[model samples]
Target chain A: MRLQDQLLFNLRSLSRQRFRTLMQLIAMAIGVFSVVLLTGLGEGGRQFVMAEFSVLGKDILIILPGRKETSGGMPPLTGGTRDITLQDAQALSRLRNVDGIAPLVVGKAEVNFSGRSKESLIIGANPEFFIMRHLRIQQGQGLLQIEIDQARPVCVIGPELKKELFAAQPALGKWLKMAGSRCRIVGILANSGTGLGFDMNNALIIPVASSMQLFDTQGLFRVMIDVHSLAGMNKLSKEVERVMQERHEGELDVTVITPASLLSAFDDILAVLTVAISAIGGISLFVAGVLIMNMTLISVSQRTAEIGLLKALGASSRQVRILFVSEALILCLAGAVLGILSAEVLLWLARQQFSDLLFIAPWWASALALIVALTCGLVFAWLPARRAANLPPVEALR
Target chain B: MIQVNQVNKTFQLGDQPVHALNNIQLKISPGEYLSIMGPSGSGKSTLLNMLGLLDIPDDGEYWLQGCDGLALDTVPMDEEVRARYRRDHIGFVFQSYHLIPRLTAAENIELPLVLAGIPPDERKERLQPIIQRLGLEQRAGHLPNQLSGGQRQRVAIGRATIMRPKLLLADEPTGNLDSHSGAEVIELLEELNNDGITLIIVTHDMDLGDRAKRKIRMVDGEIVLDKSREQEPS
Candidate 1:
């Protein structure tokens, strides 16, 4: 028979019961839709995290005070240890190819201006802090590059702080009392809405020396190091560790997190999540295949007499088999198309909610769904088609 | 022309092996009208099914003349070849009309031509005359359910002949019809027989059996009598 006529015949056979066909289409379409949507959400989550990390800093290292070793449950970490100090940070800065060092000392302080008081996190760092964090000054200026011992009284107040204290007035160069100490707001930091635990829009940024005096401590919270080239990063990190070890009397008391290891750990986690979701989606497709098999079986039994009629009309066993199999294949194709289109609509809706994250189903996800759906249709439809082909024409007619 | 030699068939009915067709031997020349009459389970329809190649005989040699000038054996033929033979040669009409309820009368008639892979334009061209001759032109687009019993059988006959098979087998074609439509269907079959198509009808109605030029009576699974009209010119 010609391919076109045979297809039309098969289609007519399926359409004989419109509700059954529609139900079958829905079952298959949902199977495909879940696969595409789940994979898209999982992959989108990974991309979002990677984008956040890249925003934090690409070629940089974070040096925390205590050694967080993976093998040990706990370390001798707290209580008057030689915390990552400003001297240690300066020693690392002297190493070759080392460009930027921003030593952070975190503490909370209450600031008062014009009788409006609010407590906010205080970050103590040098001018390189702004460059490493990709922060641009929207107002007058940032912290000046001064000696660690100078204790400059100039502080950079964030926009929210300025709004609270100054309230639509010019706040730059105004003196505010922070923790009973007078400090001039040299610049107003712009609002950067990144929520990676360091929201600068509501922070008080001052010089490292001034913060040390205000808090009456010499220890540092962490040191951020930004380098220019990716090459020689291993050597640079090793040199940094060695310098810290020597300064701490041959004790490796600090943990240095290389950018590659940090990002790679996130990558491994997200990749596992992606695979897990895809496998679950695969299981759904399997269930849809089972449903298709059952529907075909029912269809075969229902149309036994019709099948016999076709055989009597001169269709061969192979022709009958092809007709049923192709019927299932057409169903899967339509389901795949419906699933993909619905997924696009869902992803679009999600994008509107979380504009920062990309909500896209990958091309491989679509291609694999199509291939798996088609294969599932074929494999599941085989037995029923064979049963229909092997039915005794004479008895079936009866 | 058609020839059958010692054709036999048995069915496993519960614990009993029922002989549906026993040593059936018959010959039919082209353009002949034959009828077989018997009670239920007497193998009259079984014989018809065997001749239509819908059932395979246990051990028999049946030969059918073909378009390629080859006398194809129906018993030992391969599955595909046998199916092709049926497609290119034989057609069947059943008691219930077997009109493929989903298709319209026109599509039912066009089915065999479609199965034979005749292209659309040619299928249409060949289908018009059969639709006209079946007197189904007014209701050709109607589904089997909407068509009357007479019209449905006419559509079935149109489907049977659209492929222009050399042999047409009808099993109780008038069983579901009233007297008016029954006589109309019987007359249509007779007219086709007169137009040089070989016709075989299996029925329970003896009156219908008397209209054929030759008649056979079956008891159990064997043919007991064969009679031909004395005035008929073969």
Candidate 2:
């Protein structure tokens, strides 16, 4: 018989049992839907974090104080560890592939303005800190003093802190008490959204020299460096570590985290998360496969006489098997298509709800869901199809 | 056209072994019209099914020709070979008028040609004359349930002869019909026999059996009597 006729006949037969076919299709669609939606969620999360990393500049590297290496025990009490200092930052800025660098020091201090006092975080940095962090001054001039002796006792107040302290009053050029020292507010920072670790809208920014004097600290907190290119990020990170080891008396204590290393570590973790959820969804496809098997077995038993008639009309066992197998393929394929379309719709809808996070299922997730669904349907339909094909015509007719 | 030597078949019913065919010997020539008449459980239908290739005898040296111009060994033939021959050479009519329920009478009539892999135009062309002869034109689009017993049987006969097979086996062709439709169906079979196709009918009616030029009476899994209108050969 022609392939067209075979398909037509099987379709006619399957349509007779409408309820069973619909139920099986739904089960299959749900299986595929879960895989797509969950993977999309995971993939979306990965993109969101990568975007967050881009806030520090794609080629930027962070230098923290102290070595990250773990040893068997603590060091001797008499020994003192070296801290990353401003002089080291000034030296690293002169190296090759170094575009710019900002030495940072942060501390908690009490701010008393017009008899109302509140504790706030104080960020200590110079002119380059404003450029690298992308912070803008909306009201007055930003930090401009670059030398320790020339740096005056001036501060930039975040917008939220400006509201609480100065509320409907001018904040720029106003004197506020900070950590037992009085400093004049020089700039009102722009209203930017949250950053990596802390909210900048509620903090204060000052010159690194003044913050060092106020906190009485000799060690710098961390240094942020911007490179010229992607390749420069790698070269500068290695060069900075080598430079730091030498400056610290051949002791590699500072840890330099490049964009490549951080992003890749996060990528590995998120990819595993995507696969784990997809497998959980795959269990539903397995259940759908079992439903297919049960329905096919019932169909075979119900159509025994019709199968016998076909056999007597000269259909071979192989043809009969093909008919049943193709029926399963059609069912699964339709459900898979439905699942993919629904997943895309759901992802689109989710993107509308949370524009901050990227919501997109990877290409492989859809392909894997489709291939797995079809395979499940095929395997589940095998035993019943074989049973139908192997049925003896004489007995079946009787 | 066909020869069977000492064919035997047994069915195990519970703990008892029932012999459906006990060392049966039969030979049928081309263009012959024959009938086998017996009570129930006498193996008349079983014999007809064996001739139609629907049942296989346990121990039989059976030879059938006129398909693909090659003689076929019935005993050792596999399912594929048996199916090919069944499609190419044999036409079987059951008492129940086993037309596929979903197919119209026209589809049922052309089913044999479809199985034979004939193109749609050729299948339709070949079926036109048979439908005219069976007088099923008015009922061509009707399903089996919509047609009367006589019309359904005619549609089945049209399907059987659409491939122009040499052998036609009818196991109780008129068993489920009234006398009027039964006679009509028997006359249709006679017309095919007159057209030089070998026709064999298995029935319980003695009058239908008498209409054949050759008559066979089967009892207890064996042929009790065989009679021909004119004495010819063994």
Candidate 3:
């Protein structure tokens, strides 16, 4: 038969049995839907992490006292480690590629401000810390260079800390007693929301010298260095490690983490995750293929006489087989179209609800879903289509 | 013209071999109107199936017009070649109507031309006269279930003739029809025969069998009698 006529005939045959057609459509749609949803989620996670890391600064490198063999989770402490200190930060700042350096000393301290006491985290850093980390001052100016150099008792409070200790009353220029030392609030930081497990709006940033005296420790928590460019990152990091090794009498105990390396590591893990999820979705699609095969077999048996009629009308066996296969293809194509549209709607709804989580079903995901579904339908339809084509016209007519 | 000699077909029924067509021999010219009259399992249908190239005999020497000497050999014909030959030369009608239930009468009639991959407009052009001759124009849009037995048979005939084949085979064309419808179908077959097309009908009805110009009677897979009436001047 003409290709168009054969296709039309198959479509009409399917439409004649609405319930069976609908069931097959739903089965195939569910298969494609799961694939799209899972893949979209994986993509969303990757995008979300990348976005979060970008906000933390891409040109920045973090130097911790312990060496971590693995890239993710908590870093493990290695034997014979030199302590990361403010002096090490000062030496790293002399490098040409190093634009800024911050010596961080994180500690929980009780703050008594205007007779209001609240326990909050303290972030100790130099004057360049706010600029390197993208922390903006909403009110008053950040710590002055003279204050940071002279160990002045001045601090910049995060928005949450301001809200807790001052409660809408102007906290800038106000004095707050922290760690048995009183300090003037030099600035109130803008409300940058929490991400990557770090709540920037919940801590108080103070000069590194005062923090060292208040926390009663010489070893710094971690050192953050902002490099000029990607090419300069590795050179500057090696220089910092060299300076630290020389100062610690040749103990190579610090781990230098470039954001690019960390980002690529995350990319690798999430990529594998995406493929693993797609594989699970593939298994579901395979089950749906089995269901399609069963349905096609039933349809072929039921349409034996029609198959015979076509053959008697001079249809070759290949034509008969194509007619049946076309029925499966049309059904799967419809299901795939429906599935992609539904996934888009679900993505839209999720974007509305979460707003921050970047959930997107990429074009390739839709294309792959369609290709997979069509291949499954055609492959699964082969046996049943062959069965129909092999029906002897004489026996089938009887 | 058609020729058959020593054609044999066997079937296996639970380890029992049944000879469905036993050393059959027949010859037919173009435009001949023949009827095969037999009871059930008498091999009439089997012979028709062989003639239609729907089945291959276990041993046979059969030939049709334009075929080579090998066409008369007992060797099996290639399936693709047989299918192509059937498409170019033969049409079939069945007792059950066997109409695709979902297709309209017009679509049913258009099937053969469609299978031949004729363009839609040309298929319609080729179909128009056959539909008109079969008196199916009014019922052309109706499905098989929506038509009467006579109407369904007319559509089947239109389908059978739309391809304009040299031979037409009908298996019990009126077996499920009323006498009026049966008579109408037979008249249609005879009319096609009068137009220089070969016609073969398989039936158990003696009345229908006797109406054909040539008649063959079969019993137990063997032909018992073969006879033809002398032609009357037009």
Best by TM-score: 1
Name the top DockQ candidate.
Answer: 1
Docking class of 1: medium
DockQ of model 1, rounded to 2 decimals = 0.69
lDDT of 3 by residue, B1-234 (tens): 788989888999899998999889899987899999988988999999888877778887888763332334323666656666777778898888888888899998888787888899898788888888998878889999999999998898888888778889999999999999899999999999898989999998989998898999998789998888875444
Off by more than 4 A, model 2: A66-97, A105-122, A136-139, A148-153, A157-185, A188-203, A209-221, A227-253, B14-16, B39-41, B67-70, B132-135, B145-153, B174-184, B204-213, B229-234
Best by lDDT: 1
lDDT of 3 by residue, A77-124 (tens): 564556777667777888888877778888889989767898888888
Per-residue accuracy of model 1 over A33-79 as CA lDDT, tens digit each: 98899999999999988876776666888888877768756555566
Q: By DockQ, highest first, what's the ranking?
A: 1, 3, 2
lDDT, candidate 1, residue B177? 95
lDDT over C-alpha atoms for residue A130 of model 3? 80
Clashing pairs in 1: none
TM-score per candidate: 0.94, 0.85, 0.91
lDDT of each: 0.87, 0.85, 0.84
Candidate 3: residue B119 lDDT (0-100): 90
Error of 1 at A374 (Å): 1.9
lDDT of 2 by residue, B1-234 (tens): 888899998988799998888899988888999999988888888888888888899997788985666666788989877877888888888899888887899999988777667778888789898889999889999988999999999998998888888999998899899999999999999999999999999998889999999998888799999889887474
Predictions in order: chain A TM-score: 0.92, 0.86, 0.92
